[model samples]
Target chain A: MKSRNLPLNKRGFNFEMIMWIFTRLSALAMYTLLLIGFIGALLMGAREQMNFADVMRWAFMPNPSHVINTNIPDIAPWTALFWQLVASALLLVATAHGVHGLVVIADDYIVTSNGRKIVRLISMLMMASTSLIGLYILWTF
Target chain B: MGITRNVGLMTALRYKGQGPMLTFVLHRLGGMGMAVFIAIHMLSSFLGGKGGQFVNAIYEHWSFQLVIFFFVLFHAINGLRITIIDLLPKLLEYQREAIWVEWLVFIPVYGFAVFVIVSTALGSGG
Candidate 1:
């Protein structure tokens, strides 16, 4: 397998191999989604008069009389809708691909059988929670 | 033989590996970075509607975002190269060439992204 560096579980290549394959297959799709989403964000940031840096900024400063609204106007509703769709797809694919990658990494460092299982379980849980949150974020818009 | 042991960060930090090994190492590191970024991204999205201040503060800092962006940029480009090599085993013969191609793509893409971000930051007068 191309993922020769990845450590397979004691059970061998069955499920782990599937995930390794999944990552490979998902790469092109994820790359496209991320690229579009990123470019969309850049354009949207411009429309909103916000820079990429503003998206990273946190809500720490005291609020002035007026609130800081981050939503962009419906300058291009269809484009906005399309990107939301892209984001929704990205949320699912990226989470599954990323969490499995983390599991492969964990398998490398975590020696004991039980320890590996624990790490895998935590990873799955994190994946599920984040997927739900991501979907929720998409649903709101 | 016993199960593999964690080699600790000191050994891991050494860049003594070859080309393929370095790509593998960076891919793993980038994967982990993505995991962390995804977690925070989800959390921030959930809270973003309720409040904007915190998210603004985090995004306002160009330097921090640049680091994160670099990870995503490098990982995506290198990953495409790996996927291509994996799917088309014939390309394996040109592994050295493939690595060169990956770097060529990465450097220009990353450099352009940094240029845009820096320009945006400076333009905003932040």
Candidate 2:
């Protein structure tokens, strides 16, 4: 079998390569944040105060508004700065990761470079606006 | 680059790639499903009123939960498998075995989640 090396540019860092790395790293980051939220909820007495649904919601996004309607005794702990930051991080990372996935999937159907560029721009705008709205709610509510 | 060709649905379905191909299709679907879910969820949270609650009510249904949970669990596990294989190209030869292991892990976890969701809905008379 003849061993052939991939072109240097193909192997090197580029926009697509960077986004690929971002996708993997962002997945890890999401898992970490989810774990932190889950543990934090448990520490805050989620086992007794919340149902499975509520706990899952908090784990997915630790915003205080998510648990306010639940049986949790006090929303004070959840309304803290740390939880807000964690929720904001989750929102940004998840939105970016998902938007990139959309663009990659779109690339499968979109053949032209101009079409790809349009899809990428739309994806970026969607990611930015979604993150901003989510962050605003996370902080305000 | 080669010219892109469109295959008819029936023709596409006739081609068999077995486990790897099934996983590939499912992974893409799961990712897309979760992406849509996340978008709806964010918008609902942002809406934060009767409008938001209405959207929340839809997803809060047990059936929706079941589907969303399946997407999340499958995507996470399959993604981890892909990442591990990417990091260790030596595992490339064992990809089939890895898919088997992935199913072994996925089925039980997803089964338990479904069981819980169903029981909860029943308990609530939903």
Candidate 3:
């Protein structure tokens, strides 16, 4: 007699696939983002607009409340902060997705009691690192 | 039925595979490519240790432009492709199309870089 094939539900891998899908998305976005950067680097208008003295002259320009304004660049520090916020928010979502995938992949192979514990410990460490960095970017942005 | 193979003990197991696993494989490969480049960049920065004269020279090197541009172009284009894959899995078949688009975008951008470099070189005697 021939055997039957199992359905997806019946043989489900049951992997809670948490893909830090953002890393891939952001990675890809970041990949080609510099095409326009060639234009940015060539832009000497900023260089032309403000001589070092003039740049220093504008040192007392109005800054937003959040900026600690320690040793940041002269011209719009808040503009830099805006982009940083956007980036770190995406990172938060991405890290969560990554954590999910890591947990699932770990669950798949770790069989022994000690092995499972170690895997969990390592995953948690990596995840905590991702979170801390993400938060730092956000808070300091 | 058109989409159906009869489901019984006699039926063979089927994978409802929507994409060529090759796409999945290549995605990781491309990610790794970007990562290795980034690692080298960070290492160089670390080795250079703050802004010394050597570090400044490396930053300004035209040779590094190739590294910077190629990595940036691929990273963004391949990333956009992966984004589409995640958001719209059905369009995964056209993964190659995305790479082609990347190349398409790369051409003019690279051309302009050449233009800039050439102009800067010839114009440098002043």
Going through the candidates in order, the fraction of native interface contacts each one reproduces equals 0.63, 0.37, 0.18
Clashing pairs in 2: none
Q: Which 10 consecutive residues of model 3 chain A have the lowest summed lDDT? A: A54-63
Once superposed on the true structure, which residue ranges of model 2 sit more than 4 Å away at CA?
A1-10, A51-53
Candidate 1's error at A84, in angstroms?
A: 2.8
lDDT of 2 by residue, A5-124 (tens): 889686886988989888888888888999999999999999988777667778878988778877888889999999988988888888888899999899888978888889988997
Off by over 4 Å in 3: A1-16, A20-74, A77-80, A87-141, B1-30, B37-60, B93-99, B117-126
Between prediction 1 and prediction 3, the one with superior DockQ is 1
Clashes of each: 20, 0, 11
Best by the TM-score measure: 2
lDDT of 3 by residue, A1-141 (tens): 233478857755353322344455544443333222223322523354432222221221111222232233443544455445444554454445445445555555566677777877877786677666445534552
| TM-score versus the correct structure, for each prediction | 0.76, 0.90, 0.45
Compare the candidates by DockQ and give the number of the best one. Answer: 2
**Model 3: per-residue lDDT, tens digit, B1-126?**
023335664442354433434444444454445434433433443345555436545634555544554444444455566677767777666766766775687677666665554554456551
lDDT of each: 0.68, 0.86, 0.47
Instruction: Point out the worst 10-residue segment of candidate 1 chain B by lDDT.
Output: B50-59
